[model samples]
Target: MSGSREWLCYTDGSAKPGTGAPGGWGFVVKPPSGSAGPAREGYGKATGTLAKIMEYRAVAEALEVLPERAQAVVFSDNQSLVESLEKKLESWRASGFRNVDPLVVESVRLIDRAMNDKELVVRFQWVRSHNGNPGNERADQLAAQGAREAKADLAVTTKRR
Candidate 1:
Protein backbone atom coordinates (compact mmCIF):
# COMPACT_ATOMS: atom_id res chain seq x y z
CA MET A 1 0.00 0.00 0.00
CA SER A 2 1.22 3.48 -0.78
CA GLY A 3 2.11 5.53 2.28
CA SER A 4 0.08 8.38 0.82
CA ARG A 5 -3.06 6.33 0.59
CA GLU A 6 -5.12 5.41 3.62
CA TRP A 7 -8.25 3.42 4.28
CA LEU A 8 -10.78 4.74 6.80
CA CYS A 9 -12.80 2.67 9.21
CA TYR A 10 -15.55 3.84 11.51
CA THR A 11 -16.45 1.62 14.44
CA ASP A 12 -19.10 1.61 17.17
CA GLY A 13 -20.60 -0.64 19.82
CA SER A 14 -24.05 -0.89 21.38
CA ALA A 15 -25.86 -2.61 24.24
CA LYS A 16 -28.99 -2.33 26.33
CA PRO A 17 -29.06 0.78 28.50
CA GLY A 18 -28.43 -1.21 31.68
CA THR A 19 -25.62 -3.55 32.59
CA GLY A 20 -25.55 -7.33 32.13
CA ALA A 21 -27.21 -7.03 28.76
CA PRO A 22 -26.19 -8.46 25.40
CA GLY A 23 -23.73 -6.28 23.50
CA GLY A 24 -22.67 -5.85 19.90
CA TRP A 25 -20.07 -4.12 17.74
CA GLY A 26 -19.80 -2.96 14.13
CA PHE A 27 -17.31 -1.37 11.78
CA VAL A 28 -17.38 0.10 8.24
CA VAL A 29 -14.16 0.32 6.30
CA LYS A 30 -13.63 2.75 3.40
CA PRO A 31 -10.65 2.23 1.19
CA PRO A 32 -8.55 5.05 -0.23
CA SER A 33 -10.48 4.95 -3.48
CA GLY A 34 -13.50 6.38 -1.58
CA SER A 35 -15.43 3.15 -1.71
CA ALA A 36 -16.57 1.21 1.33
CA GLY A 37 -15.22 -2.19 2.15
CA PRO A 38 -17.43 -4.73 3.81
CA ALA A 39 -19.22 -3.66 6.99
CA ARG A 40 -18.63 -6.20 9.72
CA GLU A 41 -20.63 -6.81 12.89
CA GLY A 42 -21.04 -9.35 15.65
CA TYR A 43 -23.12 -9.90 18.75
CA GLY A 44 -21.88 -11.41 21.98
CA LYS A 45 -23.73 -13.32 24.70
CA ALA A 46 -21.36 -12.27 27.45
CA THR A 47 -23.29 -10.46 30.16
CA GLY A 48 -22.20 -7.38 32.13
CA THR A 49 -19.69 -6.39 29.47
CA LEU A 50 -18.90 -2.70 29.50
CA ALA A 51 -19.69 -0.54 26.49
CA LYS A 52 -16.06 0.47 26.34
CA ILE A 53 -15.03 -3.11 25.95
CA MET A 54 -17.47 -3.42 23.11
CA GLU A 55 -16.02 -0.29 21.57
CA TYR A 56 -12.53 -1.71 21.69
CA ARG A 57 -13.80 -4.95 20.32
CA ALA A 58 -15.24 -3.12 17.33
CA VAL A 59 -11.86 -1.57 16.62
CA ALA A 60 -10.14 -4.90 17.06
CA GLU A 61 -12.52 -6.59 14.69
CA ALA A 62 -11.98 -3.89 12.11
CA LEU A 63 -8.23 -4.17 12.44
CA GLU A 64 -8.36 -7.91 12.09
CA VAL A 65 -10.10 -7.74 8.71
CA LEU A 66 -8.02 -5.01 7.17
CA PRO A 67 -5.73 -5.93 4.29
CA GLU A 68 -2.28 -6.93 5.43
CA ARG A 69 -0.42 -4.20 3.59
CA ALA A 70 -3.00 -1.47 3.94
CA GLN A 71 -2.55 1.92 5.53
CA ALA A 72 -5.61 2.66 7.59
CA VAL A 73 -7.11 5.11 10.02
CA VAL A 74 -9.83 3.98 12.42
CA PHE A 75 -12.37 6.46 13.69
CA SER A 76 -14.08 5.95 17.02
CA ASP A 77 -16.29 8.04 19.25
CA ASN A 78 -14.75 6.65 22.42
CA GLN A 79 -12.00 8.96 23.57
CA SER A 80 -10.57 6.58 26.13
CA LEU A 81 -10.28 3.85 23.55
CA VAL A 82 -8.46 6.17 21.19
CA GLU A 83 -6.09 7.21 23.96
CA SER A 84 -5.49 3.67 25.07
CA LEU A 85 -4.73 2.42 21.58
CA GLU A 86 -2.47 5.30 20.63
CA LYS A 87 -0.82 5.99 23.98
CA LYS A 88 -1.21 3.26 26.57
CA LEU A 89 -0.95 0.23 24.32
CA GLU A 90 2.85 0.12 24.44
CA SER A 91 3.00 0.24 28.23
CA TRP A 92 0.19 -2.24 28.53
CA ARG A 93 2.13 -4.65 26.33
CA ALA A 94 5.31 -4.12 28.31
CA SER A 95 3.48 -5.53 31.32
CA GLY A 96 2.32 -8.46 29.25
CA PHE A 97 -1.31 -7.25 29.51
CA ARG A 98 -1.24 -7.76 33.31
CA ASN A 99 -0.46 -4.37 34.79
CA VAL A 100 -3.39 -2.69 33.10
CA ASP A 101 -6.79 -2.60 34.72
CA PRO A 102 -8.87 -5.63 33.91
CA LEU A 103 -11.23 -3.52 31.81
CA VAL A 104 -8.43 -2.26 29.59
CA VAL A 105 -6.89 -5.68 29.48
CA GLU A 106 -10.04 -7.06 27.89
CA SER A 107 -8.91 -5.63 24.56
CA VAL A 108 -5.33 -6.85 24.90
CA ARG A 109 -5.73 -9.74 22.55
CA LEU A 110 -7.03 -7.53 19.73
CA ILE A 111 -4.46 -4.86 20.43
CA ASP A 112 -1.68 -7.41 20.37
CA ARG A 113 -2.94 -8.80 17.13
CA ALA A 114 -2.96 -5.38 15.56
CA MET A 115 0.58 -4.67 16.77
CA ASN A 116 1.85 -7.92 15.38
CA ASP A 117 0.86 -6.96 11.85
CA LYS A 118 3.97 -5.09 10.89
CA GLU A 119 2.78 -4.51 7.34
CA LEU A 120 -0.42 -2.74 8.39
CA VAL A 121 -0.09 0.90 9.38
CA VAL A 122 -3.05 1.90 11.49
CA ARG A 123 -3.97 5.08 13.34
CA PHE A 124 -6.86 5.91 15.64
CA GLN A 125 -8.96 9.07 15.35
CA TRP A 126 -11.73 10.34 17.60
CA VAL A 127 -15.03 11.52 16.16
CA ARG A 128 -18.07 12.97 17.83
CA SER A 129 -20.81 10.38 18.18
CA HIS A 130 -24.31 11.11 16.86
CA ASN A 131 -22.83 13.79 14.72
CA GLY A 132 -23.70 14.14 11.05
CA ASN A 133 -20.87 11.88 10.02
CA PRO A 134 -22.34 9.29 7.68
CA GLY A 135 -19.85 6.55 8.44
CA ASN A 136 -20.25 6.89 12.20
CA GLU A 137 -24.03 6.91 11.92
CA ARG A 138 -24.03 3.75 9.83
CA ALA A 139 -21.68 2.00 12.23
CA ASP A 140 -23.92 2.91 15.17
CA GLN A 141 -26.98 1.57 13.37
CA LEU A 142 -25.20 -1.68 12.52
CA ALA A 143 -24.17 -2.14 16.14
CA ALA A 144 -27.74 -1.65 17.32
CA GLN A 145 -28.91 -4.23 14.83
CA GLY A 146 -26.30 -6.66 16.09
CA ALA A 147 -27.33 -6.16 19.71
CA ARG A 148 -30.97 -6.80 18.91
CA GLU A 149 -30.13 -9.90 16.91
CA ALA A 150 -27.99 -11.23 19.71
CA LYS A 151 -30.77 -10.80 22.23
CA ALA A 152 -33.24 -12.54 19.96
CA ASP A 153 -30.84 -15.39 19.32
CA LEU A 154 -30.26 -15.81 23.02
CA ALA A 155 -33.98 -15.95 23.61
CA VAL A 156 -34.40 -18.63 20.99
CA THR A 157 -31.57 -20.70 22.45
CA THR A 158 -33.02 -20.47 25.92
CA LYS A 159 -36.44 -21.62 24.66
CA ARG A 160 -34.93 -24.72 23.04
CA ARG A 161 -32.97 -25.84 26.10
Candidate 2:
Protein backbone atom coordinates (compact mmCIF):
# COMPACT_ATOMS: atom_id res chain seq x y z
CA MET A 1 0.00 0.00 0.00
CA SER A 2 1.07 3.53 -0.65
CA GLY A 3 2.23 5.52 2.33
CA SER A 4 -0.03 8.31 1.16
CA ARG A 5 -3.15 6.28 1.81
CA GLU A 6 -4.95 6.65 5.13
CA TRP A 7 -6.86 4.06 7.06
CA LEU A 8 -9.80 4.59 9.39
CA CYS A 9 -9.96 2.86 12.73
CA TYR A 10 -12.69 2.98 15.36
CA THR A 11 -11.82 1.84 18.85
CA ASP A 12 -13.73 1.44 22.12
CA GLY A 13 -13.34 0.02 25.64
CA SER A 14 -15.87 -1.31 28.12
CA ALA A 15 -15.80 -2.28 31.78
CA LYS A 16 -18.43 -4.06 33.79
CA PRO A 17 -20.93 -2.13 35.93
CA GLY A 18 -18.69 -1.94 38.96
CA THR A 19 -15.29 -0.65 39.85
CA GLY A 20 -12.49 -3.20 39.82
CA ALA A 21 -14.38 -5.26 37.28
CA PRO A 22 -12.80 -7.03 34.34
CA GLY A 23 -12.84 -4.96 31.13
CA GLY A 24 -12.13 -5.26 27.46
CA TRP A 25 -11.17 -3.15 24.47
CA GLY A 26 -11.77 -3.46 20.77
CA PHE A 27 -11.09 -1.82 17.40
CA VAL A 28 -12.43 -1.89 13.88
CA VAL A 29 -10.03 -1.06 11.10
CA LYS A 30 -10.99 0.17 7.64
CA PRO A 31 -8.20 0.12 5.15
CA PRO A 32 -7.73 2.87 2.62
CA SER A 33 -9.24 0.61 0.04
CA GLY A 34 -12.55 1.27 1.75
CA SER A 35 -13.09 -2.32 2.77
CA ALA A 36 -13.68 -3.14 6.39
CA GLY A 37 -11.12 -5.40 7.98
CA PRO A 38 -11.40 -7.77 10.84
CA ALA A 39 -12.14 -6.28 14.23
CA ARG A 40 -9.77 -6.98 17.11
CA GLU A 41 -10.68 -7.41 20.75
CA GLY A 42 -8.96 -8.40 23.96
CA TYR A 43 -9.85 -9.21 27.55
CA GLY A 44 -7.77 -8.49 30.58
CA LYS A 45 -7.84 -8.51 34.35
CA ALA A 46 -8.99 -4.94 34.81
CA THR A 47 -9.34 -4.95 38.58
CA GLY A 48 -8.51 -1.49 39.88
CA THR A 49 -7.84 -0.25 36.37
CA LEU A 50 -9.49 2.85 34.99
CA ALA A 51 -11.68 2.91 31.91
CA LYS A 52 -9.32 5.43 30.34
CA ILE A 53 -6.55 2.90 30.43
CA MET A 54 -8.71 0.46 28.57
CA GLU A 55 -9.59 3.14 26.05
CA TYR A 56 -5.96 3.86 25.43
CA ARG A 57 -5.27 0.16 25.18
CA ALA A 58 -7.86 -0.08 22.42
CA VAL A 59 -6.06 2.58 20.40
CA ALA A 60 -2.69 1.00 20.98
CA GLU A 61 -3.97 -2.42 20.00
CA ALA A 62 -5.40 -1.04 16.77
CA LEU A 63 -2.13 0.63 15.89
CA GLU A 64 -0.16 -2.52 16.63
CA VAL A 65 -2.24 -4.54 14.19
CA LEU A 66 -1.94 -2.16 11.27
CA PRO A 67 0.66 -2.59 8.61
CA GLU A 68 4.01 -0.94 9.01
CA ARG A 69 4.23 2.48 7.32
CA ALA A 70 0.47 2.80 7.37
CA GLN A 71 -1.14 6.19 7.91
CA ALA A 72 -4.38 6.17 9.86
CA VAL A 73 -6.97 8.22 11.69
CA VAL A 74 -8.21 6.47 14.84
CA PHE A 75 -11.67 7.37 16.11
CA SER A 76 -12.38 7.07 19.81
CA ASP A 77 -15.36 7.87 22.01
CA ASN A 78 -13.24 8.82 25.01
CA GLN A 79 -12.63 12.53 25.09
CA SER A 80 -9.88 12.28 27.66
CA LEU A 81 -7.98 9.80 25.59
CA VAL A 82 -8.36 11.94 22.49
CA GLU A 83 -7.27 15.09 24.28
CA SER A 84 -4.28 13.40 25.84
CA LEU A 85 -3.10 12.10 22.52
CA GLU A 86 -3.77 15.24 20.54
CA LYS A 87 -2.84 17.94 23.05
CA LYS A 88 -1.20 16.61 26.17
CA LEU A 89 1.23 14.04 24.85
CA GLU A 90 4.07 16.44 24.16
CA SER A 91 3.76 18.20 27.49
CA TRP A 92 3.59 14.93 29.30
CA ARG A 93 6.79 13.84 27.57
CA ALA A 94 8.52 17.13 28.39
CA SER A 95 7.53 16.79 32.01
CA GLY A 96 9.09 13.36 32.01
CA PHE A 97 5.66 11.96 32.78
CA ARG A 98 5.34 13.77 36.13
CA ASN A 99 3.24 16.30 37.99
CA VAL A 100 0.28 16.25 35.73
CA ASP A 101 -3.28 16.44 36.98
CA PRO A 102 -6.03 14.65 35.05
CA LEU A 103 -3.31 12.80 33.24
CA VAL A 104 -3.01 9.05 33.01
CA VAL A 105 0.55 7.88 33.38
CA GLU A 106 -0.52 4.29 32.84
CA SER A 107 -1.53 5.07 29.26
CA VAL A 108 1.70 6.87 28.49
CA ARG A 109 3.55 3.68 27.71
CA LEU A 110 1.05 2.64 25.06
CA ILE A 111 0.73 6.17 23.74
CA ASP A 112 4.49 6.41 23.51
CA ARG A 113 4.63 3.13 21.67
CA ALA A 114 2.13 4.42 19.14
CA MET A 115 3.82 7.79 18.79
CA ASN A 116 7.27 6.34 18.38
CA ASP A 117 6.28 4.06 15.58
CA LYS A 118 8.10 5.57 12.64
CA GLU A 119 6.14 3.38 10.28
CA LEU A 120 2.74 4.64 11.45
CA VAL A 121 1.14 8.04 11.13
CA VAL A 122 -1.77 7.95 13.55
CA ARG A 123 -4.25 10.72 14.31
CA PHE A 124 -7.09 10.59 16.83
CA GLN A 125 -10.71 11.70 16.26
CA TRP A 126 -13.24 11.86 19.07
CA VAL A 127 -16.76 10.62 18.37
CA ARG A 128 -19.75 10.66 20.67
CA SER A 129 -20.52 7.26 22.10
CA HIS A 130 -23.81 5.49 21.28
CA ASN A 131 -24.72 8.29 18.91
CA GLY A 132 -25.79 5.99 16.10
CA ASN A 133 -22.30 5.61 14.69
CA PRO A 134 -21.99 2.14 13.15
CA GLY A 135 -18.28 1.68 13.72
CA ASN A 136 -18.36 2.92 17.28
CA GLU A 137 -21.36 0.77 18.10
CA ARG A 138 -19.69 -2.33 16.70
CA ALA A 139 -16.56 -1.61 18.64
CA ASP A 140 -18.60 -1.25 21.81
CA GLN A 141 -20.28 -4.59 21.25
CA LEU A 142 -16.96 -6.31 20.63
CA ALA A 143 -15.56 -4.86 23.81
CA ALA A 144 -18.51 -6.10 25.81
CA GLN A 145 -18.09 -9.56 24.34
CA GLY A 146 -14.45 -9.50 25.28
CA ALA A 147 -15.28 -8.62 28.86
CA ARG A 148 -17.77 -11.46 29.06
CA GLU A 149 -15.24 -13.84 27.55
CA ALA A 150 -12.66 -12.82 30.08
CA LYS A 151 -15.02 -13.48 32.94
CA ALA A 152 -15.93 -16.83 31.47
CA ASP A 153 -12.30 -17.76 31.07
CA LEU A 154 -11.64 -16.95 34.68
CA ALA A 155 -14.54 -19.13 35.70
CA VAL A 156 -13.26 -22.06 33.64
CA THR A 157 -9.80 -21.76 35.09
CA THR A 158 -11.17 -21.72 38.60
CA LYS A 159 -13.15 -24.87 37.88
CA ARG A 160 -10.06 -26.62 36.57
CA ARG A 161 -8.29 -26.27 39.89
Candidate 3:
Protein backbone atom coordinates (compact mmCIF):
# COMPACT_ATOMS: atom_id res chain seq x y z
CA MET A 1 0.00 0.00 0.00
CA SER A 2 3.07 2.25 0.17
CA GLY A 3 5.68 2.76 -2.52
CA SER A 4 6.00 4.30 -5.93
CA ARG A 5 2.57 3.87 -7.50
CA GLU A 6 1.07 3.62 -10.93
CA TRP A 7 -2.56 4.18 -11.84
CA LEU A 8 -4.43 3.09 -14.92
CA CYS A 9 -6.88 5.79 -15.85
CA TYR A 10 -9.44 6.38 -18.56
CA THR A 11 -11.61 9.33 -19.49
CA ASP A 12 -14.16 10.44 -22.07
CA GLY A 13 -16.46 13.34 -22.81
CA SER A 14 -19.71 13.82 -24.72
CA ALA A 15 -21.53 16.80 -26.12
CA LYS A 16 -23.84 17.62 -28.99
CA PRO A 17 -21.88 20.79 -29.89
CA GLY A 18 -23.10 24.38 -30.05
CA THR A 19 -23.45 26.80 -27.16
CA GLY A 20 -25.62 25.82 -24.23
CA ALA A 21 -25.63 22.22 -25.41
CA PRO A 22 -25.70 19.48 -22.88
CA GLY A 23 -22.17 18.23 -22.22
CA GLY A 24 -20.61 15.78 -19.84
CA TRP A 25 -17.42 14.03 -18.77
CA GLY A 26 -16.43 10.87 -16.95
CA PHE A 27 -13.29 9.23 -15.61
CA VAL A 28 -12.12 5.92 -14.13
CA VAL A 29 -9.12 5.49 -11.88
CA LYS A 30 -8.08 1.93 -11.21
CA PRO A 31 -6.26 0.86 -8.12
CA PRO A 32 -2.51 1.40 -8.13
CA SER A 33 -0.39 -1.44 -9.36
CA GLY A 34 0.14 -4.24 -6.83
CA SER A 35 -2.68 -2.97 -4.66
CA ALA A 36 -6.20 -4.18 -4.03
CA GLY A 37 -8.97 -1.60 -3.98
CA PRO A 38 -12.11 -0.63 -5.77
CA ALA A 39 -11.74 1.51 -8.85
CA ARG A 40 -12.73 5.15 -8.45
CA GLU A 41 -15.02 6.96 -10.85
CA GLY A 42 -16.71 10.31 -11.39
CA TYR A 43 -18.93 12.17 -13.82
CA GLY A 44 -20.22 15.68 -14.36
CA LYS A 45 -22.84 17.14 -16.62
CA ALA A 46 -23.77 20.66 -17.57
CA THR A 47 -25.08 22.90 -20.30
CA GLY A 48 -22.99 25.50 -22.20
CA THR A 49 -19.87 23.32 -22.22
CA LEU A 50 -18.01 21.63 -25.02
CA ALA A 51 -16.84 18.05 -25.23
CA LYS A 52 -13.19 19.07 -25.19
CA ILE A 53 -13.64 21.15 -22.07
CA MET A 54 -15.51 18.32 -20.46
CA GLU A 55 -12.74 15.93 -21.36
CA TYR A 56 -10.16 18.23 -19.78
CA ARG A 57 -12.22 18.51 -16.65
CA ALA A 58 -12.57 14.73 -16.49
CA VAL A 59 -8.80 14.20 -16.59
CA ALA A 60 -8.23 17.05 -14.19
CA GLU A 61 -10.57 15.69 -11.55
CA ALA A 62 -9.36 12.15 -12.02
CA LEU A 63 -5.76 13.20 -11.60
CA GLU A 64 -6.67 15.09 -8.45
CA VAL A 65 -7.49 11.85 -6.63
CA LEU A 66 -4.12 10.27 -7.09
CA PRO A 67 -1.70 10.53 -4.21
CA GLU A 68 1.15 12.96 -4.60
CA ARG A 69 4.14 11.66 -6.62
CA ALA A 70 2.06 8.84 -8.10
CA GLN A 71 2.76 8.02 -11.73
CA ALA A 72 -0.40 8.14 -13.82
CA VAL A 73 -1.10 6.77 -17.25
CA VAL A 74 -4.24 8.49 -18.48
CA PHE A 75 -5.99 7.08 -21.52
CA SER A 76 -8.45 9.23 -23.40
CA ASP A 77 -10.51 9.02 -26.58
CA ASN A 78 -10.05 12.67 -27.48
CA GLN A 79 -7.04 13.33 -29.67
CA SER A 80 -7.15 17.07 -29.18
CA LEU A 81 -7.20 16.65 -25.45
CA VAL A 82 -4.30 14.25 -25.47
CA GLU A 83 -2.32 16.51 -27.75
CA SER A 84 -3.09 19.58 -25.72
CA LEU A 85 -2.11 17.93 -22.47
CA GLU A 86 1.04 16.36 -23.83
CA LYS A 87 2.20 18.92 -26.34
CA LYS A 88 0.45 22.25 -26.18
CA LEU A 89 0.26 22.87 -22.47
CA GLU A 90 3.62 24.58 -22.12
CA SER A 91 3.08 26.83 -25.09
CA TRP A 92 -0.39 27.69 -23.93
CA ARG A 93 0.98 28.68 -20.57
CA ALA A 94 3.84 30.65 -22.11
CA SER A 95 1.21 32.91 -23.60
CA GLY A 96 -0.48 33.31 -20.24
CA PHE A 97 -3.46 31.33 -21.57
CA ARG A 98 -4.55 34.41 -23.46
CA ASN A 99 -6.72 34.11 -26.58
CA VAL A 100 -7.86 30.69 -25.51
CA ASP A 101 -11.47 29.74 -24.98
CA PRO A 102 -12.29 30.78 -21.46
CA LEU A 103 -13.81 27.45 -20.49
CA VAL A 104 -10.92 25.57 -22.03
CA VAL A 105 -8.46 27.83 -20.29
CA GLU A 106 -10.19 27.25 -17.01
CA SER A 107 -10.21 23.50 -17.52
CA VAL A 108 -6.52 23.47 -18.43
CA ARG A 109 -5.75 25.54 -15.40
CA LEU A 110 -7.44 22.95 -13.23
CA ILE A 111 -5.38 20.25 -14.87
CA ASP A 112 -2.14 22.15 -14.29
CA ARG A 113 -3.16 22.87 -10.78
CA ALA A 114 -3.93 19.27 -10.12
CA MET A 115 -0.61 18.16 -11.48
CA ASN A 116 1.59 20.86 -10.01
CA ASP A 117 -0.14 21.25 -6.67
CA LYS A 118 -0.46 17.51 -6.19
CA GLU A 119 3.03 16.81 -7.57
CA LEU A 120 1.66 14.01 -9.73
CA VAL A 121 3.39 12.80 -12.86
CA VAL A 122 0.99 12.13 -15.72
CA ARG A 123 1.34 10.60 -19.16
CA PHE A 124 -1.43 11.19 -21.65
CA GLN A 125 -2.34 8.46 -24.14
CA TRP A 126 -4.94 8.58 -26.86
CA VAL A 127 -7.13 5.55 -27.32
CA ARG A 128 -9.49 4.88 -30.17
CA SER A 129 -13.09 5.32 -29.10
CA HIS A 130 -15.46 2.33 -29.28
CA ASN A 131 -12.66 -0.06 -30.19
CA GLY A 132 -13.82 -2.50 -27.55
CA ASN A 133 -11.46 -1.34 -24.83
CA PRO A 134 -13.27 -2.01 -21.58
CA GLY A 135 -12.01 1.01 -19.64
CA ASN A 136 -12.65 3.33 -22.55
CA GLU A 137 -16.09 1.85 -23.07
CA ARG A 138 -16.93 2.18 -19.43
CA ALA A 139 -15.80 5.80 -19.34
CA ASP A 140 -17.81 6.44 -22.50
CA GLN A 141 -20.87 4.90 -20.91
CA LEU A 142 -20.43 7.14 -17.90
CA ALA A 143 -19.97 10.19 -20.09
CA ALA A 144 -23.08 9.33 -22.08
CA GLN A 145 -24.93 8.92 -18.84
CA GLY A 146 -23.65 12.26 -17.70
CA ALA A 147 -24.85 13.87 -20.90
CA ARG A 148 -28.25 12.33 -20.30
CA GLU A 149 -28.16 13.53 -16.72
CA ALA A 150 -28.07 17.07 -17.99
CA LYS A 151 -31.57 16.47 -19.30
CA ALA A 152 -32.62 15.25 -15.84
CA ASP A 153 -31.05 18.28 -14.16
CA LEU A 154 -28.51 16.29 -12.22
CA ALA A 155 -25.34 17.55 -10.63
CA VAL A 156 -21.74 16.30 -10.77
CA THR A 157 -20.91 13.22 -8.70
CA THR A 158 -17.48 12.13 -7.55
CA LYS A 159 -15.61 10.23 -4.84
CA ARG A 160 -12.21 11.71 -4.14
CA ARG A 161 -9.38 10.14 -2.22
Error of 3 at 110 (Å): 0.4
- Model 3, range 29-110, lDDT digits (tens) per residue? 9977678888899898878767887888889878887888878889999988898789877778778878566778888888
Candidate with the greatest lDDT versus the true structure: 3
Model 2 lDDT tens row, 4-76: 4777788888777553366777888777864556544443434444567677778877777777777888899
Q: Candidates' lDDT values, in order?
A: 0.75, 0.73, 0.82
Clashes of 3: 0
Model 3 weakest 10-residue run by lDDT: 152-161
- Model 1: CA > 4 A from native: 1-4, 18-20, 34-47, 157-161
Clashes of 2: 0
> How does candidate 1 score on lDDT?
0.75
List clash counts for every candidate, in order: 1, 0, 0
TM value for model 1: 0.83
Task: Give each model a TM-score.
Answer: 0.83, 0.78, 0.85
Ranking by lDDT: 3, 1, 2
Q: Lowest summed-lDDT stretch of 10 residues in model 1?
A: 38-47
